[model samples]
Target: MRLNNKTKAGYFNFLGTLVIMLFIFGVGAFLLEYFVYDYFGWAQWLFLIIPIGCITLFYARGRQIFEYDSDGEALNFKNRNVVLFLDKHLSDEFPKYKLLKYDVVNIIILKRLYVSISSKKSHNITLRYDISYLTKKELNDLKFSLSKVIKNNKERKREPSS
Candidate 1:
């Protein structure tokens, strides 16, 4: 089934990047300026703009979709765009992949499709696109193909399974 990317894909990514950039800049400037020298002086502000004008390219991106057959298991997560940020370990524990922007993904069609993708640093970013982004045919096909998995996602995890 054909799926659409997040409605505010650029904006959302921008916001996320901005937050990350600020944190990185804060730490980096402190380290370099404090340890290295006070050489940065006024030029430090210009250096900060590097992150501002950084890349916002979305490569190999098209309609994102999923299949029910043998999905959501322990899929390899070498290169993927995660959406839900479900697994804490995926976000917190893995070595960061850089250069590439979400090439391949290990998907779990949970309450919503959780795309497990990596970010520039060791940051694991998840972007969720709801059914509203799907076309009528694709939505129907998704429902028909994996209704159970979708339903299962909606159930509260804290509650015991019936």
Candidate 2:
């Protein structure tokens, strides 16, 4: 899926909050240092800098785009990808029935909190992400693309039977 500029801005804003928090804390630390450590040593300043540095690095690394594919594969921001194979317990519980294909599941946007995809067979998957990053148009387009992929896959499956 294509990430629009608004998504990028949302990521930046998420990280920006951390930077702002660090700046505020740093200022507070400086004031504390002057009041309590002026006659002592520079140890407090060192302690404060360490946490701020760590927080900045953590946020910088966390900002990225996420991609999910039709086959329940998830590609994270770090470029790591994994296929979500159904577990044996789930498979046994939800035995596949004719005309009910788990792989035919498509993405569904629910309210403002959750995104779910469910197959005709009842197998389902859901993800919770910061959707506030997406504009209405971008979200609509993404949903359309995902739906099309799912529909195509279903069509391919039916073609073998025909």
Worst 10 residues of 1 by lDDT: 95-104
lDDT on C-alpha atoms for all candidate structures: 0.41, 0.44
lDDT of 2 by residue, 31-82 (tens): 7877866754766676467667766554434223333333323322111111
- The best candidate by lDDT is 2
Q: Tens digit of lDDT per residue, candidate 1, span 37-80?
A: 88867766654565543422221232223222313332222212
Return the clash pairs for model 2, or none. Answer: none
lDDT for predicted candidate 1 compared with the true structure = 0.41
Root-mean-square deviation of candidate 1? 15.3
lDDT of 2: 0.44
Q: Model 2 misses residue 62 by how many Å?
A: 12
lDDT of 2 at 51: 60
